[model samples]
Target: MDTIKKLLAAGKFDVVLNQLQERMLSDESEERKDALYYSAVALRYLGRLEEAHQRLDALLDCWSDFGRGHQELGHTMYALGREETALQAYYQALKLNPALYASWDATARIEAKLGNLQQAELNAEQAQFLQKQPKQVVGALNLFHEGKLFKAERICRAYLQRNPHHVEAMRTLALIGAKLDVLNDAEFLLESVLVLAPDYNRARYDYIKVLQRRQKFPQALAQAKLLRSDEPYNPLYKALHANLCSALDNHDEALSLYDELLSDKVGDVAGVYVAKGHLLKTLGDTKGAVACYQQAYQLQPLFGDAFWSLANLKTYRFDESEYQRMQAAVSANETRVEDKIHLNFALGKALEQQEAYDESFSYYRRGNVLKRETSQYKSEVLSQRVDAQVEYFDRDTVARWTHTSAQHRHLTPIFIVGLPRSGSTLVEQILAAHSQVDSTLELPNIPAIAHELNGRQVDRKKPLYPYILDELSAQQVEQLAQRYVDETRVYRSEAPFFTDKMPNNFRHIGLIKRLFPEAKIIDARRDPMDCCWSAYKQLFAEGQEFSYGFDTLADYYRDYLRMMKHWNQVFPGQIYTVFHERLVNDPELQITNLLNHLELEVEQQCFSPHQSDRSVKTASSEQVRQPINTKGIGQWRKFEAHLAPLKKALGDVLSEWAY
Candidate 1:
């Protein structure tokens, strides 16, 4: 590869091509990707534009996110006198990687020729900024965009070691940290970058993102507001601010901002439409949301989020035309992996609605496979984590922890914990319908607290979290409880009791009992086949990575049961279990039992939770908006033939949890 590069630089294009072709014939390994890419470059330099285009097409077919491949395609298109096509290719290249200065330069030239002065100037400025960056920083940025995060982090850290306090390097490292899911480090690095370069709008934008990922909504919103205040007309800043506002429940302001962006007719119009559609969906305006989602897909035919949004409505059905377009989008090579994932899931739902069970299952499996390839989840890691928790939080430990004096006894947080798609959201809606109960989102406080206790460790074999509870003084435990109440206050109203329906909180019941012994814990239980299959079909925005594969999903369900049973043994009669099938079969009797367990008087409205008009954010948002029914009970039966692995893995849990 180095020799080929040297040959190309020496203007020996023919020699470069010969070397790459010889290497490709002998090497059918990953290096072939490099060979194909370099061959395209050689062909373009030799003025064999057609061959260059074909080579780039083949390269991108296998590696669609290769930004340099797209940039070379742009060059080939320009050499073939297809200026508009070249411009589009350049835009695609930069979209994959903004670090591609050559693409930015080409785009700027083309836009200038087309008399788009503002866009041209912006492109030129971006190219100039990238050009001015240190070579290490530039290379790190490229690696980061190319998904080589570890390499990027190493380069960034080595550079930062020599040039300490360099804000750009710090920001670059922070971006890599965020990608690696070390969000606390990312947040701290971004904060440091802003302190050094307070006027750096880019760093500020990054800071807001890290804060948002950390679930510090108020802090993220404050930073977003500052960014918007600095450039009130900047559409990106305005859109981000609006998103934060929506997260913080400032719905009116979020809607107004979306309207402003729409009326201005600038900056991600289709995306704005989708955002508005989501807000409208949450607000229960099904008609308005449908219109906005339709408008989005019409504006951008391959926009997969719009299609998925329509499908996620649960009640929406795709027409023939819409269905055909989705199929075409999935087949298109230009469609990105992220978009393809969405399209596959959307198509699966569409086919399922049409009762094409076999085809629907195929699409669902394809989507999950694609998603699993990109995920960092390891079943062994999760299994080991659960094992650690079970081993550490034994009955004796629980007895000692529960004896710790409680601080926020007044804050009776109703924790709805279970697997996703296990009717946890439905339970929250029911509880929220009670006049004395307030419903919050899947609160991250518990997981966030556990994460903090985990600290930064080199070996995963030795974790500090559950064990740390043993050392915590009563005052420290009380302080942690106070922090939970204070941080979550923004998500609550005046209701004496508020529900924290974070499904994954089942893993941390030990910590919860230590902090607030009186807190209510509800185990939302569902039939194994129904729960596992439901989770398998859904594409969660984040987390729940185990749901992407049948084996993993089954293993996770078993682990959940093990942990829950252990919790029950430790705190007998403390955790309440709500069977979803029973609730659907006998709504009145089940709801009465649920309320009675919570020590609350049953209200007539609890029977009709679907009419509450509160915003429901889960995938069941649409399902929970209607009366309870048995529609979802045996959904896995449709694809039972394909679920052999799930059944084999689930084993006895099926019979144990089956209704």
Candidate 2:
């Protein structure tokens, strides 16, 4: 590969092609993907435009997100005197990777020749920006876009070692950290970059994104306000501010910003429409949301997000033409993997609505397979973590760390913990309907704290969190508990209690007990088959990586049950279990029992939680807005034939959960 790169750099295009061809004869490994891309580049530079185009088409057919492959195709198109095709290729390249300087340069030149002066100038500016970056930074950016995140991090860190104050290098490293799920390091690095380069709009923008990812909505909104103030008319900044507002539950402000962006005819028009649609959906305006989603797909027929949004409503049925469009989009060679995944899921839902069970399962399986290929989830790693938790947080260990002081006993956070798609959101809605209770989004604070306590070497054989909890002093415990309260205050109103319906919080039940001994914990349970099957079909925005594969999903459910059972035995009667089946079957009785468990007086509004106007930000948002029903109970039965692996993996869990 190094020799071929050297040959290409030396303009020995023929030699480069020869070497790649020889390597391709026997090397059918993953590196062949790179070989194909390099061969396309070599062919284009050698002025073999037709061959280059053919190679690029074949390469892209297998690797749709290959940004450099698209860039080389752009060059080939230009050499063939096809300016429009070349421009489209460049656009696609930049869509996959904005850091491609050559693509940006080519786009600028084409736009200028076509007399799109404004767009040409914007493209020129982007090209110039990339051209001005340090070579190492540019290389790191390319590697990052290629998904070689560790390599990119190494480059950025090596660059920063000598030039410690280089904001670009720091920002690039921070971007890698965010991608690697090291949000704490990413947030800190971005903060430092902003402190050193206060006027760096790009750094500030990145800082806001990191903050948003950390679930620091108010802080992110504050940064977004500063960014928007710096460029008040910038459509991207305005849209970002709107998103932050939506995150903070300022839906009216978010909708207004979306309207402004749309009316101005700038800044990702289709995306803005989708954002508006999401806001409408959260606000319980199904008709308006559906219309907005329809408008988005109408504007960009290949936009899979719009199609998925409609399907995710769980009740929306696709018309014949819409369904055909999704099929065509999924089948299109130009469709990227990310878009293909969304289209597959949408098609699955559409087929299911039409009662084409086999076809529906095929699409769902295809989407999950594609998604799982990209995920780094290991079921054993999660099982190991659960084992550590169970081992470390035994009865004696729990008793040792139990908060005895009344200093923090009043901090009664109602944690609804379970697996995703297990009706946790419904429990939250029911509790949030109570006058004394506030509801927040799936909070990330507990997980963030756990990550911090796990120390820097998180992947070590033994983690530091649950063990470290035993070593903390009373003051340290109080401070940590208070930090949770203070940090989460942004997400609450004047209610006496707030609900943190983070399903994964079940893993940290011991920590929760140590922090707030009097806190209410609810174990949201569902039929094992239903829960696993529901999770397998859904494409979570993030953090539910195990759901992308049936075996992983089943293993995760089993781990959850194991961990919950341990917590139950350690702190008997401290956790209330809410079976989703019981809740749906007898809402009033379940609601009464739930409130009684929390020692709260039942309100009439609790029985009619679907009427609450509070925003819901889960995939279950649409479902929870309607009356409770058994529609989702036996959904797995439709695809039972295709669920052998899931059923086998679930094993005794099916019988235990009475599925």
Q: Which candidate has the top score in TM-score?
A: 2
Cα displacement (angstroms), candidate 2, residue 36, comes to: 1.4
- The TM-score of candidate 2 is 0.97
lDDT (0 to 1) per candidate: 0.89, 0.89
| Candidate 1: tens digits of C-alpha lDDT, residues 1-659 | 78888898999988888777776655564578889999988888888888888888888876777888888889899989999999988988998898999999999999999999999999999999999999999999999998889899999999999999988899999999888777878889999999899999999999999888767899999999899889999999999999888888789999999999999989998999999899889888899999999999999888999999999999999999999999999988777788889999999999999999999999999999989988878777777778888889877776555444454566799999999999998899999999999899998889988887988551378788788887888788889999999888889988889999989999999888888888999999999999999999999978899999988998899899999988998889999999999999999999999999999999999999899889987889999999988999999999988899999999999777654
User: Worst lDDT window (10 residues) for model 2?
Assistant: 402-411
Off by over 4 Å in 1: 22-29, 402-407
Query: Which pairs in model 2 have colliding backbones?
Result: none
**In order, how many clashes per candidate?**
0, 0
